[model samples]
Target: MLYNLFNKVSSMNKFAALTKHFAAAVFWGCMMAVPGWAQSPGGTEKELIRLQNEWATARIKGDVAFLENLYAKEFRITAMNGSVVERDADIAVFASREMKPELITDEDMKVSLYGEVAVVTGRENLKGTYKGIPGEFALRFTNVFVRRDGHWQLVTHHSTEMRKK
Candidate 1:
């Protein structure tokens, strides 16, 4: 009788181990099938920051084509003067020789992610030529990004000049 009881307990222990292994396998399988399920909040934030840096680099290089790929179809921007620029116009401005951005830097950025949407707020310090006029400006900017088709796209942007204290 003692041998039989020991055998039963050993069987139960084996079953429990099997159940645990099965549960872990199922969880990992689901994560593999669903792209969103596998991503962590920290990973999302890092990807968003990387995209922002890519955008800044594109601006410095005057690579509007690269920016176009990163922007959404209905992308828009509000200038420091409160003027709204649509997708085509924004690309045009960037493509223009007069809008040369010698230096484009993002500083003190705060990035927040909510599911598929992200908001980034930061200071953009620009040293460039505007219509043959060399000037420098520091602006506080907010850029909104949304995840679509497994990629993040910039949908909206707004900037306001940073005034002297």
Candidate 2:
């Protein structure tokens, strides 16, 4: 009888050990499935910065297709003049050649990551023309990006024209 009891207890212990390992495996599997959970901070930051550079290049080259793919459907921008423009409207300006951007450069860009969201703050120097009026401006800008479906998309952009001191 004692031998049988010992065997039963040993089986139970083996079952418990297997259960513990299974639970751990399931937990880690879920974590891996979460978007951006496995990305290192350094890698993510570099990717975001690259995206920002791509955005500038797209603007300069007037690549409407790239702009359309980079910005989310709900994307919005608050211009230096405090006017808010939706994604379609903003794209329209580029599509229609209403806003000609000669140069768009980002400087002092700092990126902050929050799980699936990132915020980039920086200074932008722009040499461009709007409505046939040539202009040069220095601006401080904030760009918000969100990770969705394992990719990042720009969601919001706000910029203020810097005053010359």
Candidate 3:
């Protein structure tokens, strides 16, 4: 009975190993079948950050159309305070706010790329007035961009404000 049980277990192990290898080959084959899009990491990273900077400038200028063009159709923004805003709502925030011509200066910026996706992370000092109300926030912002159809669009964004020590 012991010998029979060991033989059965060994057969099952062989079957499992065979299945694992088969699945791995299928996955690799599918990956190879997928076409690769031409993504330039150097220029793309620069363009994406430039686009985000332009978005902030437009926000200060209260230009919704510019913001609209800068963002992807399905943009998701999350504030440091855990507040979430979608594409429309994000553009609306700039439209509704009365801008007093301010500026966002990025202190430190880092850009990284993976395939067709690029992420830009930076610390920015923002100074502005909204609706005649004085406002200032030091934000660490992350902007994610994707290259699609030979165009880079802002896909996801997040901002977190640090507490004063």
- Clashes per candidate, residues 3 or more apart or on different chains: 0, 0, 0
- Model 1 lDDT per residue over 63-145, tens place: 98888899999999999999999988878877886588888888888888876789999998989888889989999999999
Q: After superposition, how far is residue 100 of candidate 3 from its true place, in Å?
A: 5.3
Clashing residue pairs for model 2: none
Reference-based lDDT, each prediction? 0.86, 0.92, 0.80
lDDT of 1: 0.86
Off by more than 4 A, model 3: 1-40, 98-101
lDDT of 2 by residue, 85-150 (tens): 999999999888889999999999999999889999999999999889999999999999999988
- Per-residue alpha-carbon lDDT of candidate 3 for residues 1-165, written as tens digits (9 for 90 to 100): 966865777777978977999999999887787554433456666776788778768877888888887789999989777988899977876888755548777767798888678889999888888678887889998988887777778899899997877
How many steric clashes does model 2 contain?
0
Predicted structure 2, TM vs. truth: 0.79
Error at 3, model 2, angstroms: 16
Off by over 4 Å in 1: 1-34
Q: 33 in model 2: Cα distance from truth in Å?
A: 6.9
TM-score of model 3 (CA atoms): 0.69
